[model samples]
Target: MKDGKAGAVTELKPSRPLDHADALRAHGSSLLLIEGNGKLDKVTVKGDQAEIDTIKDGLAEPVSVTAVGGTGWIAEGKLSYIIGDNKGKDPGPFTLTPVALPK
Candidate 1:
């Protein structure tokens, strides 16, 4: 991790098979969000083991994700948002929040 100090890169293995993860974002510490298989999953790492939890599900092929101030907006078949209580911690039950995608 290149937070500040230069050190050897440590590989974090996901608890479950990724299958086809297309997008990823890092949250505080070892928490991450992966977009794949029409869903968004939040992953956390402890030591060398990682765990995945579903944050959002049932979308049309989500491919990318971007976050700001601990809030993430996903681009599935459409660019919309799923609001959750995650702010660098706590994998949440995220819900969809509608937004107008640019035409």
Candidate 2:
């Protein structure tokens, strides 16, 4: 697989590491990973639990991504993101509303 070093991962800047959420976004064949759901737990990853907020207003499309409830958290795991020259139906420019998950 190609790493985010070759500009493949355009937008990836999470507070912590890239978890399942980000991994899913990377499916778009890009290195960027945007969180969709504001909640982190919503996106279930393999071998690790998600931890992030939710996408309140809407969401920004990463190359490909796996968001939780709504908030975008990087729980940890392997996922795929897709990024290419789409005609115009690109996702993103979304909300950054942080949320809290129930214990």
Q: Which structure among the candidates has the greatest lDDT?
A: 1
Work out the TM-score per prediction.
0.57, 0.21
Residue lDDT tens for model 2, 1-103 = 3575553433433334543343444321222234433223223233333333333323333223343653334332111223334434544334333443332
Give the TM-score (vs. native) of candidate 1. 0.57
Q: Which candidate is the best by TM-score?
A: 1
Which segments of candidate 1 are over 4 A away from where they belong? 1-6, 9-11, 77-103
What TM-score number comes out for model 2? 0.21
lDDT for model 1, please.
Answer: 0.59
Root-mean-square deviation of Cα positions for candidate 1 versus the true structure, in angstroms: 12.6
lDDT of 1 by residue, 1-103 (tens): 3788898766877777775677667766544454556666777778767787777666654667666565667765332333433335544344443322221
Q: How many clashes (backbone N, Cα, C below 3 Å) per candidate?
A: 0, 43
